[model samples]
Target: MNRRFPFDIARQEFGRASRGNVAVIFALAALPLLVGVGVAIDYAKSANVRTHLQSTLDAAVLAGARESSPSAQIAKAQSFFDAQRPEQFSAKTSASFSVADHVLNGTAQAEVPTSIMAMFGRETLDVSAKAAAASSSGGKVCILLVDQSRSQTLLANSGAKLIAPDCEIHVRTNVSPGAIINAGVNLDVKRTCVKASTVINNGGSVGNLEKSCDAISDPYAGKMPSVSIPGASCKSENYNPDVSTVVLPAGNYCNVNFSNQTSVTLNPGMYGGMNFNQARTVKLNPGLYIVKGGNWNVNSGMTFTGTGVTIYYADNSIIQFNGNVNVQLSAPTSGSYDDILFYEAPGLSQSNWVINGTSSSTLRGLIYLPSKAVTINSVSNVSADKATMVFASLILNNTNWTITPGNKAMASSSGGAVRLLY
Candidate 1:
């Protein structure tokens, strides 16, 4: 589910055209919504409460559905509704949310003080909106390719298998040789959609595929983390502690170069260019980590226990890991970035994320990298437990790995596409 890099000459020649393709795809996808909205202007011929109420309700339910916990879902929905509901109806509009069987249902009610219908003896028009959203039930995209110009954006080498039958694999590139499946590669996915064609080498097999489909647009294009955290500044130098055992506080730390035999406890906050050079045991507290720029490299004999965390990778950052390391990291269960582990902030620069950890490493979350290519070359079996959604520019698999990216059907992005299923 990944590939080789495109040549610099190719990038220069086709970069503009590729971008144009994305615009066209976006316009086409938005056309239906635009039309639907235009038809809504009449809004029962009143141009009143119901129309805006419906849109806001839809958004609230969708936001709620993205979270895993019931309380978090309801809280997020109410927050969005309160913040975005029309000001004119702020005092009159109210909404409630509930979750059942993984589906988030919401209802909004508003009383429009009739501006024109008052003469008809009706002082107020009672209106309501209902919406439902499911975060998981299959059919959601697990692996997404955002680059449209490069050939081999998705390449599955020999013995590689994409073990995601519960999700869809989308190839957005329409260029020839868009995707290649080498010998012994088996795409074990629900469906594989390609804009152009998939070249199959000897003994390559693709199950449930659709060719010549419209490119699936990036759902997390503009919803990246901020380049810098609010009220926080960059650290000036490297973190070299005097003692072998340390408990780093929740603040900005620069140049995270770890040495051998150091037992360190890192409280959640901002870190710069984390590198694990020697054997060290690192424990991460539950919180958010805003890591700005540089190589997040991990090497030899390191044990890490980090559950309930989110790593927001900003700027031109890359992830490199080696075998012989044991690490377990789980994503946060609540908040705006819930269910997401690695969130790559949008940038002009393109990068690569290489995960080459050993069998003992367990990571649970959506590795959301919208502007990078990722390669999973784990020598031994590692589980993507609880959640394992991989959103990238492209993905490569060189081993037989079973990736069940959870059962939740929501997009990795909070602003991702959501329909009003009444």
Candidate 2:
């Protein structure tokens, strides 16, 4: 019974049977594509949040490092982070600030909320940033000029030779030609760095001169020991003895003037002004000499000797040595002003100081004047044994200066710079 079935009925049967299988295959293939698109959206959102959090943390840590106190540092970090973070997102932040071995370290972490990834049981993205800053204390600085207005802060005139083999010279002027060396001037140092862009060397020899360098801050400003003047017990004296040799005790002298071929020995104490003219020899005992509101002048043919001593100047005081003076001075080995020979008061206006040392001059300490300019003029054959000089400005005119490492180490008075290290 070979009976022929209807063609239309067979075709309809086949179409009905394959419709369910085709739908099943299409659904199976589309599931992976949907999942992949969902994952991409979630990951992209997380990455954006993480980047923002990281940048915010970095800024917060850098701002925090400027604080000296640990508690203040943490507070500052939190404040900065709050200011920089996005308002649309919520985040949990944790920060820590510490100082170890003179280094300031700041660390911050942020946990940001995730929107798309939350569907997959991931709710947050973790981000962190760390920073470190420190001040430097090593390296000897031969010359430090703090004047920011002058185009030529350090000038080497004709026949001048300034030599410092183991140290650097820092100039803070931002004008053109922060340092200028004229004809026949020779400036030879280990390094000469200026904050300005231009340095003028006119027919002179300069060694390792670099422009646009970092500017250093005043290290001893407001950090020096204060000077106290006695009230009722103060005494006034003018010592011009006829005798060849005279010894003075340590006390409060209002005005002191010594001259006329006399040899004077000064005990360590406080004085108003010490004026010496045409003296044969003057000696300073090993202690502190605090001078206030006066000019310390050694004029014309005087031989001065001081060891283990420090001279403190305050209130519109000046130090001037003229006409071929022989000086030998060294700083104290142990004290509040250790390795410091000369110190000036802070918050004072600019004053003039001229140091003219002869061939026999030997200064073995630090000379620090935070708010004044120092000029070394026509000085020859002077030797600095572990000596460092810091001032608001400097001028070297027709002099030959040499420095060598001696009994004490020549360290920077200004603490090193603070910079972000991540």
Candidate 3:
């Protein structure tokens, strides 16, 4: 062994050193695996942070959107984030906000620092979140439509206010100037520019109603009883014919229309189901018309005009004003006959309806005021139950309307859950 050459000994040493280096190579090979595990953990943490940030941002955005003021919205958003997480940890937080025509949109971003993964030279991971909210500052209006063609009085009796802070009054009527206009909001004669006559006070602030007296322009504006319903226990129980029966026991008369140009004036008496099928015209003189039984159906271009009329629907009584008829309800009751009025507007069909009521009368069904306003002038009590009253502006003149519990009342009190989105 001692007789070995120097070169041979060197070669053997080199081979041994190469074999030792295998361990180093194997360790180096596992470095990427460790890096991968660290990366996965970092990603998981980032995802968790992202979810949290996203949820918080969503809540904040929603809160901001509900607010009407844009500046307030921004403040609220910032407050939300501050309350959720500290600013110190939000070093790399990114946020953007914008508002356009009452619509608020925003986005949020943050960075999640990699803990174990940083040891492998990975510094941090990025996480982002976004949310949006919309604020509503649009105009809120309730159009009041009245049939001035017929002698109707627009009254403000209950504790009611206009739909908007400043509302414009417009009137164009086919009726004469004797129509009574009670002013509760304003009394400036100049403001009552509408071509109407005789504006009175409603014991409230007469804001500008007087100045806008001549504001409206347009015109004029049923019925029956028959046992047309079958499969019913009561006589008029389930009977809903196109024409319904209304009996004004003695001194009461109900309005009946036979055509648009022609109307049949009925006296206070009982009526069989009147045909509202072919553009019928009807007129009612004064007095109460009681519902004995049957449904009133309006089919085509029918018009029902009333001068002084009162209609009462018994517990089981129902009135179905069909879709095609243009019915005008006029009457002088304890409240105001102009409770339901209609005016002329562009693109609006003459086929509209006007309704009036006294103390605490419940109306059930959809009532569309296509052209004018739905004036609830009943100072004593009135309720529009299950109805859709549309107008340019909805006016709640001191018309005694309250929110009471029960199906017999309006969907009020239960949050006054009236949804008006125009």
Q: List the residue pairs that clash in candidate 2.
A: 136-416
In the range 71-178, model 3's lDDT, one tens digit per residue, is 555776677775774233343676766654344566788877877777767777777776665423221112224445543334444355332232223333334442
User: Which model, 1 or 3, shows the larger TM-score?
Assistant: 1
Candidate 3 stretches with Cα past 4 Å from truth are 1-15, 22-29, 32-348, 358-367, 372-379, 383-388, 392-398, 403-422
Best lDDT among the predictions, by candidate number: 2
Model 3 / residue 358 / CA error / Å: 4.3
Taking the tens digit of each residue's C-alpha lDDT, what string does model 1 give over 301-355? 7777788888877666655678767778888777776777878766646677676
lDDT of each: 0.67, 0.72, 0.44
> What's the true lDDT of residue 269 in model 3?
44
Give the worst 10-residue stretch by lDDT in candidate 2. Answer: 407-416
TM-score of each: 0.64, 0.63, 0.32
Clashes of each: 7, 1, 76
Model 2 misplaced regions, further than 4 Å: 1-139, 232-234, 405-422
Off by over 4 Å in 1: 1-137, 224-227, 230-243, 386-392, 407-422
